[model samples]
Target: MSFTLEFFATPEIPEVLKECLRVLKKDGRLCVVAMNQKDDPTLMIKLYEWAHRKFPTFVDCRPIFVRKTLEESCFPVLDSVEIFAWGLPIEVVLSKICKENSKRS
Candidate 1:
């Protein structure tokens, strides 16, 4: 099984991941694309954050945070990519469902 999440961010990422894991079969893959924040904020980054703040649907989650959350939710990352989306840096992460014994908090 496979699924993709795009164009939105939410604080309930872990919960969402949990739900994904529940339905995914063994060895299933999941992909997520989200806004990326840089160590040195650029004008575009600042503007993106500002615009995201104005909208409740956009959470502006960083890549590291999302990776950690995925691990916590029992998904092991397989690959990741950083690319530009509409002039804003975005992260694309691919993770797979972990073995049953490894799926724990």
Candidate 2:
């Protein structure tokens, strides 16, 4: 079996999953690593919140909703796990925010 990796950034996760399933071959495995909601107070979420406040629909990405989307896409999730995440210093997080803001502006 050939190996292909696809990464998508879509507001409609169900459509993305459907498209992935349609292209995947039989017996092929898919590894989906999505950052839906973080369990920790990470820089990513902080930046997202900052962006959201700046522009309300900014990066209006939707969560996968796990079970429902997978089932609908005809993909059975064999296993799932959650590892404890870490946090970053405020300066680094703020720097990232400034960079992102600059790019957008």
Error of 2 at 18 (Å): 1.6
Candidate 2 lDDT by residue in tens digits, 15-99: 7655655565545455554334534546666785566567766554322334334545555656554433332221100001112
> In candidate 1, which residue ranges exceed 4 Å CA deviation?
1-11, 55-64, 101-105
Score candidate 2 by TM-score against the native: 0.45
Q: Ten-residue segment with the worst summed lDDT in candidate 2?
A: 89-98
| TM-score to true structure, per model | 0.67, 0.45
RMSD of each: 4.7, 15.3
Clashes of 1: 0
Name every residue pair that clashes in candidate 2.
Answer: none
